[model samples]
Target: MNQRNSTQLHPPTRHFSVLLSPTPRGARLARLLATEWLRTWELPHHATEAAEHLVAELAANAATHGRLPGRDFRLALLAGSETLRVEVTDTRGDDLPHRRPATPDGESGRGLLLVEALSDRWGVELGPVPRKTVWAELDLSPEFGNVCSGGSGALLQETREGKKPHQAPPLPPTEPAHSRE
Candidate 1:
C-alpha cells in the first residue's frame, strides 16, 4: 500500500541531516554529502558551491577544534524559499568560534574568515550540554546568481588590490555561472 504524509501532499521542505565522527575524513564527507544534496534540491550553482565550502569549513572546525574523545558532530542543511542554512554541531560547547583577522601569509586559521565572506550571515549557538552549533546562511534569492557571479575570484582580486574584504564592492557579474564542485 502507498502511504503519504501531509508534507508529501505538497512540496516537501528541503532538509538533510547526518552525524559523523569527529575526524578529518568525516569533515570531508560532510562537504561531499552536502554538495550532492544541494544539487538534488536543484539549487543554482552559486548556492550549491557556497554551501559546499561553508559545510567544509564548519565541519573542519568541528573536527579540528571541537572534537571530544568519543563524540561525533552533526551536520544539518535546511533550505527555505530564499535561503540555505548550514549547521555543524560539535561537542565543545565551551569553545565558541570568533572570527579573527585573516593573515596574509599564514597557512591556516582562515576557515571562519572564508565563512564570513561567503555566507550572508553566520554565528555560533551554544546549547543543551556539551554541544555548540556553528551555523551560516546563504541567500538563495533571485539575486543569488548575479550577486556571486565572480565567487572567490572577486575576493582574491580585492586582496591583490590591497582592499580589505569589507572595503571591497559587491562581486560584479564578470563570469557566467557554473558549478565549481
Candidate 2:
C-alpha cells in the first residue's frame, strides 16, 4: 500500500495545548477549557465529564505539588476517536505522583485515586530536563463510534465491546536501535 493509504487507517487526531500560571485559577481554567474543547468536538457527556475530572485532578496536582517559583505548567489535550488523553506538564521532575489509600476521614491525598477511577490508563513521563507530564486517558468508544474522527470513512476502531481497555499509548517515538546479528 502507498504511504498515504497506510496513514489513512489511523483515526484523525486533534490537539490543544496551553501554558498557564501554576495557580488555583490555572487549574480551574484547565478543566473549563477542556470541557469547551470537548464540546466543540461533540464528545459525549460521559467522555467530557471524565475528561474534565481527569484534567482537574492533574492540573490541581501540578499547581499544588509541582510548583516552582516563576515556572508555569502546561495543559495538553489530545483527542482521538477512541480516547481523550489529558496531560499536565509541570516543572517538578523529581516529584512524581503516587496514589495511596486515603483514610476515610483524611482531608487530602485522594486526587490520584479519583484520576485512577476515572481513567482507563494513566501515568507520568519525565522529560528532557526539570519537567514531568502527568497524563490520563478516558476511553470514548464505548458510547460513541469513530465516525466523528473527521477522517475519511476508513478508520481504526479500538473498542471491541468485550475486550479489555487499551494500554497507555506508547512513549513518543524515538530513533530505532539497530540490531546486530
RMSD of each: 10.7, 9.8
Candidate 1 residue 125 Cα shift, in angstroms, is 1.1
TM-score of 1: 0.73
TM-score of each: 0.73, 0.74
TM-score of 2: 0.74
lDDT of 1 by residue, 57-168 (tens): 9999999999997899999999987668899999998877754466789866888668766776666667878888887776565342344623343332222234232222
Give the per-residue lDDT digits (tens) of candidate 2, residues 1-181: 6564344567679899999889999999988998889889887777787788888889999999999989999999998877788899999988877664688899778887677666667767789589999888766765334332211111433445546554543444442211100
Error of 1 at 126 (Å): 1.0
**Candidate 2 RMSD computed on C-alpha atoms after optimal superposition onto the true structure:** 9.8
Q: Scored by CA lDDT, what does every candidate get?
A: 0.74, 0.75
Judged by whole-model lDDT over C-alpha atoms, candidate 2 comes out at 0.75
Query: Number of clashes in every candidate structure?
Result: 0, 0
